[model samples]
Target: MNLKDFKAKLKNKIWRNVKAYFYDQRIADSTLVQNINLSTAQNQKKAIVSYVTYSHFNDWENNNIGRTQPFEILSMVKVLTELNYAIDIVGCHDLKTLDYLKLKNYDLIFGFGETFYQLTMLHPNAKSILYMTEHHPNFTKIEEQKRLDYFYDRKKKKANTVRTGNFYWDHHMKKKYTHVITMSETEPFNTEYTKPFNIFPTGILNNNFKLKPKNHDSSKKHFLWFGSYGAIHKGLDLLFDVFQKHDDIVLHVAGFYKDDRQLLEFPNKKNIIDYEYIDIQSNQFLEIIETCTYCILPSCSEGFSTAITTTMRHGLIPIVMENTGFNRLNELAFFLNDFNIEYIDKQLKEYSTKDSEYLASLSEKVFSFANSNFSIHAFESKFNVILNQILKND
Candidate 1:
C-alpha cells in the first residue's frame, strides 16, 4: 500500500479502538471539560452539553471526514460559547447518577442522555433544551420492531435490534423541555412537544477530491448503499435479496456493517462490491461516486441521514424511503414507498432503465440540492438562528 493509504488505514484503526473503548467502558465520571475557556464573570451563564465528548481530544480537522457527530458537537460548543455561556460537555453514554450539589448552578442544559435527563429534572429554573438527532423513541421502537419482524419472516431467524434509540424517556415526547432542536422532520412522529420546535439541517464534509465525469450509461445500472452500522435497519437485507436475483445490476456497499461477514455472504454476491468502512476523503469513495448513478437507503428512521446527503453531494441521485426524515428533498429524490423485496426490486429495475441523460440530470439536481442544504455552513447558520431564538424567547 502507498503511504497515503497506509496512513488512512492506521487512522481508522486508531479511531475504531478509541470508539470501542468509550462504548465498552462507558466512562460516566469522566468530564470532557470543566469550564471551557470562558471569562469567569460571577453572573455569567453556564450550560452543559451531553453529547460526544471524545471529539474534543481527537484531530479536529479530520473529524469531519468520517462521522458527523464530532463536527456537530464542536459546532454546538462554538455556538454556546458565542452566546456567552461557559460550557461543560459530557459523553452521551455517561449514565451514572450525577451530583446535584455541583450541577445546580447551570443556567441551561442541552443535548441528550442520562446527563441531560438528570440535569433537567434537578434544575427546574434552568432552560432545558433537548437535542434530538434521531426519530422519537416511540416511533423508532415501533419501526425497528416491524423491520425485525419482516427480517424474521424472510430468514426464519431473529436479528438483533441495532438502530433503536438508547434512552426513550429522556426525549421531548415523554418529558417537558424549554425548547427542542432536532435534525429530522418531527411532525406526526414527535408532535408531543408544546415548546418551540426547531429543525436544523444536517451537515456534510467538504471533500478535497476533484469531481470526475460520470458514465451514466454504465452507472445507470449501478447503485450505492452507504450507511454506518444497522445494516438491517437501513434495509440492506432488502437490497441483498433484490440484487442477488438480478445479476446485471451492480451494488456498491460502503460503511461498516456490524453483520458484514454474514450479510456479504449472500447467494449471488458477485455483483455486490463491499468496501468496508470507507473514508469520505479517500479515492475509494471517489471511485464509488463516479461508478454509481443512484444511492439507495430504506432506513426505518433517521435524522436527515447524513450518509444519503453525503452521497448526494457527489452527484448520486438518492433513492430513500419516504417519511424517514427526508421529506425536504421533495422531488429531488426517489422515495421508496415500501421496503419489501418485490417493491424495491421493481423500483430499482425501473430506475435503472431510465435514459442516461435523464439519470445524469437527476444526479445534477441531487448534487445541487445537497450542496445548498446540507453543507457544514448551512448547519451552523441554521443552528445559530435557532439558539438565538431560544435565548431571546427566555
Candidate 2:
C-alpha cells in the first residue's frame, strides 16, 4: 500500500478502537440507538426493513438540521403497517444489529445512500431502494468541490474526508441497490432503477407560514441568506462581497458560521444584519421570513434546500442557483446563472428597481409554489404513489 493509504488506515484503526471502547456507554445514552428495535405484531404483507432513526418520525422532535427529516420516516413505516406488512426499523448507525435480524426474510428494503449496502447484505433477493440525496463523483463532484474549495475556507483534510466518503458511497456502496428516488432530474444516481421525485423536501412550515397581506413597504428591498454550516459551500463569501457593495437592498443572514473568524472577516456593512444561528422554531426565524421579500442561496450543490422551501412558504421569492436542487426556479424565483459579483450585482440592481406590485405578485407565486409542492399533504400523496408501486412490483 502507498504511504498515504497506510497512514490513513492507521489513523482510522486508532479512531475505530477509541470509538469501540466507548460504543456501549454512548449507545446506552443515545435516543436513536435505544429506539432501534424490531417492530411488534406480525402483519399480512411481505416484511419490510428500513434504516432510519425513530426520532425522525416525530415532527415535534425534528430539529430540521441539514434538512434530514424532510418527512417523518415513520409515516412510511406506518403506511406499510396499515397495508398489513410487518415492519422492522433500525438506526442507520447500528451496524451490529444486522447480524441478529433475518435479512433474507425482508421482501423490501429502503435506505438512504450507503445504508443500502448494509441493508442488502446476504439478501440478494430483496427489492432495494436508495433515496438519493447528493450527486457523486464524475457527475458534478469535481465542479461542486471546486466551488466549495474556492468559496469555503474549510480544512483540506476535512474536505477530502467528505469527498472520499461521498465518492465511495455513491460509486461503490450504492451499486447493489436497484432503485433510487431523487429530488432533481439533474442529480446523477447510478442505479438500475431511478425515479425523479421533483418536489423539494418539506420542513415544519404549515399554512401559518404564509404571511398574508405582506406589508410591501417593510419587505421591499429586504433579502435573507439562511442555511446551516459550510458557509463557502453555500456561497456566503460571494454574498458578503456583493451585499457589501450594494447598499440598496438590506441583507439579513440567519445561519451558523463555520468559524467566528469567518464572521469577523466581514466588516460591518450597514445594510447587512447578522442574526447568527436562528432556530426554526423561534419567532426570530419566522420574523426574518415574514419581513424579507427574497431569500438568496447560491449554493454549490444540494439534494434539496429546506431554507428555500421554508422561505417560499412565508411568501419570499428565492434567488438561487440551478444546482441548488430546485429545478426551473425561473418560473417563480430569480435563478442565478453565475455567482460572479458583476452578474449578481446587475440582478440585485434589477430587483431593487422592481415595483412593489410586481414583487408582491412574485411573492404570491412563490407562496403558491411552496404550498403546492412542499406541503406534508403533497409529500404523503407522492410517497404513497411510490410506495404502492414498490409493494406491487414483480
Candidate 3:
C-alpha cells in the first residue's frame, strides 16, 4: 500500500480504538444522563427548554458562555404556548448541574448541551433542537496530532477530560435528529441524515445588557487578539511573534489564559494588558473593549463567533485572517496579511487616523447587518418556526 493510504488507515484505527475505550467508561455517566431525562419526559406535550446549563452563573459550569439563554428559552416557551404549542425540555442529561423544574408536561425534547445522546432513546417521540457546542475534526483520516488535540482518544473533544462517554452516540444522535443547530467548527459532519440542520445566531445575555457608553482616547489605538486557549487552533501562535516586535501599540486579550513565563517572553513591553475575561454583557465589558480601536481574531477555525458580532456591533475594526469565518467582513472590517505586527501596525495606524465618519460607517454597516439577520428577535423567531416543525413531525 502507498504510504499515504497506510497512514490514513492507521489514524482511523487509532481513533476507533480510543473511541471504544471512552465508550466503555462513559456508559455509566450516559445512563445517569438518560435516567434524568426519562424522568423529565414522563408527561404529555408541553413547551420545553431544549438548551443546557441555563443556571450556570459562570463560564465553567456551562459549556457555552455569553448572555443568559435559559431565560430566553423560557420566554420562547411562553411564545410557543401562546401559539398553542406544547413544549418540554429534553435537557439532555445534566440533571446534576442543571436547574430542575416541574416540567412534567411538554410536547418534545430540545438538545442544548453535552447530554443530548441520552435523550435519543427516550425522546424519539419528541422533537429536538440539536444545538452542538463542541469543536471536532470531521475527517476519518485526520492527522494524528489533530485527533489527539480533539481528545478523540479520551472520547472528549478537547477542553475538560471529564465525561468522555458517548462520542459515537453523540454523532449518531447528531445525524439522526430532525433539527440540528451548530456554530462554526474545525470538523463539521454534514450528512444526509442531517439535512435538516441549520446554523443560527448564538444567543447572548438577554435584554439585561444594553449599549453602555465607552469613550476612548480615539486618537491612540489598541489592538485585540482573542479566543479560548484550549482551542489554540484559533491561531494565537500565528500572531504573537509579530505582535511582540512592535512594542508600540497595546494588545488586549479576552477569553481564558494564564502565562507566568510571560515575564521572560516579552519583558520589553508595557502595552499588553491581559484582562483574562471581560464578561461579554457587563457594562464594564463594553467599556474595556471600547478602549481599544481594533478587534483581532486569529482563528484557524470558527463558527460565526458572537465576539465578531459584538466587535462589529461596537464599531471596532476587526482585523481578521481572510477566507476564515471573517470572509464576508471585508466591507465592514480590515484584513491582515499575516500575524506580522508590522502589517497589523500599518493597518491599525491608517484606520486609527480616520475621522468619526469611518467609525460610524463601520458601526452602521455592522448595526444594519446585525439587525437584518442576527438580532435576538431574529434568533427567537427563527427557532420558534423550527419548534413548530418539530411539533408537526413529532
Most accurate candidate by lDDT: 1
Give each model a TM-score: 0.86, 0.78, 0.60
| Per-residue lDDT of 375 in model 1 | 75
Q: Specify the highest-TM-score model's number.
A: 1
**Would you give me the overall lDDT of model 3?**
0.51
In candidate 2, stretches whose alpha carbon ends up further than 4 angstroms from where it belongs are 1-51, 56-71, 102-104, 136-140, 152-170, 173-176, 186-199, 206-210, 215-218, 258-264, 328-330
lDDT string, candidate 1, 77-152, tens digits: 8888888888888766565536523544788988887777777777888998888788777677888898889988
Cα misplacement distance, residue 307 of candidate 3 (Å): 2.2
Off by over 4 Å in 1: 1-30, 61-65, 100-103, 170-172, 194-203, 260-264
Question: Considering only N, C-alpha and C atoms within 3 Å, which residue pairs clash in candidate 2?
Answer: none
Distance from true location, Cα of 359 in model 1, Å = 2.2
How far off is residue 108 in model 3, in Å? 2.6
RMSD, model 1, all Cα superposed? 9.2
Summarize candidate 2's per-residue lDDT along 1-394 as a digit string, tens digits.
9999999899999988898788756644432322123445533435444455544443444334434352546556666665666666665546666666643376667765334466676567787776654544454466566765554443332332133244234444436565666655444543444554443567556424545777766677888988776666676767777888877788898874756344436548889888887777667777887778888888766666778877787788888887556665668877888877678888887876678888888888888888897776777677777777766755
Cα RMSD, each candidate: 9.2, 7.2, 12.8
- The whole-model lDDT of each prediction reads 0.77, 0.65, 0.51
- Residue 301 of model 3, lDDT score: 40
